[model samples]
Target: MKKTIFTIACILSLNIFNSCSEDIIDLKPPYEEIIEDAIKSEEDVNKFLMGTYLKISSTSLYGSNFFFYGDLLGDTFFRSNKNFGGYTSLIMMNYDPINTGDINFYRSAYDVIQNANFVINNELTDSQLNKQYKAEARFLRAITYFNLLNYYAASPKSGLNQDIGVPIAVYPYNPDEKIARSSISDVYKLIVEDLNYAIENAKAETTSKIYITKTAAKLMLSRVYLTRQQNGDAQLAYNLTDDIINNSPSSFKLFTSTTKDAFKNYFSSSEDIVAENQPETIWELDMNVLNNPGVNSSLSVFYSRTGSKRGLLAKQTFYDSFGTSDVRRDLFSFTSIPVEDNPKGVWMAKHERAAQPGGNYTRNNKILRFSEAYLNRVEALYQLGKNTEALTNLNEFASLRNGSAYSGGNLLNDILSERNKEFFGEGQRFLDLKRYNLPINKGTNCPGNCDVPAGSKYFVFPFSEGQLIINPLAVQHPLW
Candidate 1:
């Protein structure tokens, strides 16, 4: 079965490469050539699916772009002085209305979405194969749309439904055709629907926690419901995810021995990972520095200082947020080694991997974890007025970092702070800020009045001008 699947995957990959290249260049081939040669068998279909997975390695999405844009562009982090050009301009509030970085992110997200749609719409028809592959594709599509919507459109309640989101292109593209921006509601609706289908139809045996599985679908649904303020649905989704964690064959345990072990083991190793169908992880980007050079290069960009060139560093605020007792502070941040041209300064945690004497650094980009599931359950319980249950779960996680148990305050606030500390530099701060409706500290470095009070606009990024050009129907987000 594995060999058959592998062979099919290769054929499908070749087909996708030829098809995508032809579409980009506007090659006019006969209709029969296009349809008949598209995909041949179940094996071909599997290969096309692999191609979609391959695109995640691109710099813009799961690769370096995810690390840099998600962390550097937000507060609580900054570019290292050695590697501080466009990044300083970004974090220091120097982005213009037409920033090229924003444009690159926009195009990259669309590229991933397009590949997912191709698999969903064109490949996999056998009932067994269709069920498995479709679920994976749907999960990928939903994740891509979620990222794009968060970056390029307003939050759901911003009344920007009429505003164009990134184009929802869901098929083989015809270069000559014009696409319009989809409404935020429509886009979200599609995302939810896709996730629901994936949850119901995806094969449990073929799934793993690291890859998209039924639990991942539930987790994503919870997230979407929370974003839309659908409390009941959110609670339902969270409950479902929690049940998976509590009852799954794989156990989700926090590192109770020490903070350093918690950070290092959780992020850098697979000890905490729940396999495909288990509970600890719902979905994770499959990244390894050994076979996948793209993920390796991207992470290297963040930590590399080959002379005076540094990439990004931890912010002073982030360092200050932790108390003297918090060991995560030391584990996540580091001082630079003195090299001939590179002066020493504080660098962000190279926790993902240790520097190799002459070999490349390698680590998986963990997109989700069992810890997140525990947090989700706690938050949902709190929102549902089950404060006691929420606190119980909250303290359980906190106790893992240190031997001391948590004495909780405001349930929501405790959850937020816990997330901030646990997930710092993991590309989750901005989402936390948006979800809690907290104002981002524009601070002294903001280009205009740093004092502009935060609200919905602060949470939503504006659509790129280039995207608007291609899809004129897309409208600028309000209060941009």
Candidate 2:
């Protein structure tokens, strides 16, 4: 059974290498060709790891769609007529099982997982460096699995439907063997186990924030723990985040200054393709001029009016969610006067670039940062019944962003509201809403379904009909 799945992964990886090579020119010696050599040397292992990063950085995955899909599914942004029509079906939520709108992203994720599996299943010399390499591989595989389950399966907190999860392929299965979705609990178990290994053995420091590090692993683990919400998991999550915020030896620090420039500077400068100087950045995908998602697929293009294909615009209600005095509000601006008459709508300055409209639209995609650590800790504290402590921390975080302090009201809602404000274009709102089982409030800008209920089928995306056909034991998402 294991061998069969392994063979299948290899075949898929070959197709990925051929089709994806043009976009990923930085990855030397195509991944599929290197697999036959068994990744024996240190250089080969590094190339393998870098190849996985390239896959993750693809436009179909984290480079754009992951963040775009999250915000589009939620109430924060609506598609304008300027869009290329690639995601109209996604926003309308009207696509069928045979033509799932996000098939490219699904395939890209599996390509990454397959690359990681190859690195983990092979061995280099018995050196400490090799252990770290394997640890990084596990971390990549775990995070990829978590993303799959988050999108394709019900949350563990979803109760009845939680048993219907995505397929597990940690080891190769026989060619003749059937494949089936693992339970939510089982997939979460793998995520936690792999992250624990990453925390114990991954590299502590590297030249840039693009590489996986122990701190990034800890931050990611806290997210997994918080999402699962099992017994004592909140406390565990809080501890991990707290340690990173207060005790970790790395240079990570929250922005405490009152100046808006300080807050704006936290994001990479427009001239920067890869920012090593940003202290808040824990992990970012390198989008240098040499390798970037082109203008058609770049976030800079989709979110800014300067680009030809600009379509995503901030909803007015969501824009108003930020108070007038809040520094975060400075990140947005109207392209026309009277707000209502603006055809381009409100532009989010988060993904700024120094280029002309037709120039390179490169910008580093930040995956993890210090701000998220504080948010995670605050939520964990609230869950642990430490209301006063959570409030204190929340206010401290808010004050730094030049925002009003939170008075004692509903703590969870306040925390979530802060997250919605802080992570608008960064791709977190929809998933946050889903894990908490909260209804998606589309406000008044919705073009299709106005309100998606807590347990709606739309919350969990469907597998394409081709996917189900290839694996007979695989179950299509319920009600798709």
Candidate 3:
């Protein structure tokens, strides 16, 4: 299936550049000419922008790395010992310095960033082109950078203050030119600038619910500010998103069905989503078999029998975290054959498609969800000492899935645990732990027993070695 898609993509690429290449030796046309000749038509612009979306949805970006490298690699979700290969090597105590997969993921993410930047910097001149499309593209660029910074760079206050993050390329770069990472602060500033521009200029168009919107920009800003510990800014951003959500209560209702139904509904149905939003999504990587193939490889590899055996499974601790009464446990776990020393009870993440019968791919990748926004608001409010309000909102979300509002401990702890349940398998647990300074347990050794100390520097992923090799100005993390 993937091969078929790749063939089609290559054909399309040939068709897209055939004219320019026939007239000029190199396919690299001036940005102006490409925009004037290739993108002047609405259909042409739409098709070209689809390529940008494909990059974000690619296996290296949201489709697989976002889940495996970002979330499952952390302590919360675990790949049972029997299936521990790439994940255990990359994330668990066994640090394999030569993992090429990590390098590939990084390159893929940067490619998406580059494509987005090209569209934003050069593609928006048509008087007839809707402004919303441009805004959506910009929103995607900001999102791509936000993920890169979080994964590749240290916190704002870390000694690597002036350290560079992945390069913030806004224009196409020559393949031969050595790219250098930009400072974390500079990257963030560019993200903010793009998001701000998107919010202001996006008023002229409307897009599918799966695409980013003005509200999605606000939600992302809220996340960015929270990550930087800029409380005031975080509060303001959340407030803006809250206003948008609250203004149309009828449009956004929590899923109050059975946990399985609730979880499935978020992805398969649109009823639970806000009227203008994609159900279960604040932003998603648009994908289709016809135009996207690289984005499908992650799915192929994840469920491939010949690939890494590290299929989804709850860490023993994560599985134990859920009480028997908690329905989410049932929703996420699945029985899978034990790969090695691990027992038969080994579980895999059931949230995503396990495997397509004999085939290995699945459609589309989900990035942000409205539920995350609700949690962000709840957590921010709890931190701000608005405990009562926070609990109220938290319970509102909980009630939808659990059949009753959560009755738990202190508001802060409850919110934290709720996040674990809400975002399980979504690649957020690791980030949440780092942000809150929590400890990571690196699982067992020989028989598989390891534990990472709480707040240890290892919790933070180091910048890729390739990044440093190319950008001498780049700073490595403390322990690396």
Most lDDT-accurate candidate = 2
Candidate 3 has what TM-score? 0.78
TM-score-based ranking? 2, 1, 3
Per-residue alpha-carbon lDDT of model 3 for 210-232, expressed as tens digits?
45666667777777776766537
How would you encode candidate 2's per-residue C-alpha lDDT over 332-418 as one tens digit per residue? 767631233233357777876547344666467888888999999999998899999999999888877877788869887899889
Q: Choose 2 or 3, whichever is better by lDDT.
A: 2
Against the true structure, what is each candidate's TM-score? 0.79, 0.89, 0.78
Q: How many residue pairs clash in each candidate?
A: 9, 8, 14
Q: Model 1 Cα displacement at 220 (Å)?
A: 2.2
Q: Which 10-residue window in model 1 sums to the lowest lDDT?
A: 1-10
Q: Find the number of clashing residue pairs for candidate 3.
A: 14
lDDT of each: 0.58, 0.75, 0.57
lDDT of 1: 0.58
What is the Cα-based TM-score of model 1?
A: 0.79
Residue-level lDDT of model 1, residues 1-480, one tens digit each, is: 111111122122223332222222232333223432555655545555566666665656776566666565456555544444455434644454476463366765666666566567653455866667778788888888988877776665444543566677735555545677787778888998998888887655333343566656766777777666553766775676677666643434333446565455545443324222233344555444332444235565465443223555555555666666665655554545323223233455533443434444435555666667777777778767888988998888776665234567666767877876777666777776665556566442233424323464545566567766776666666656
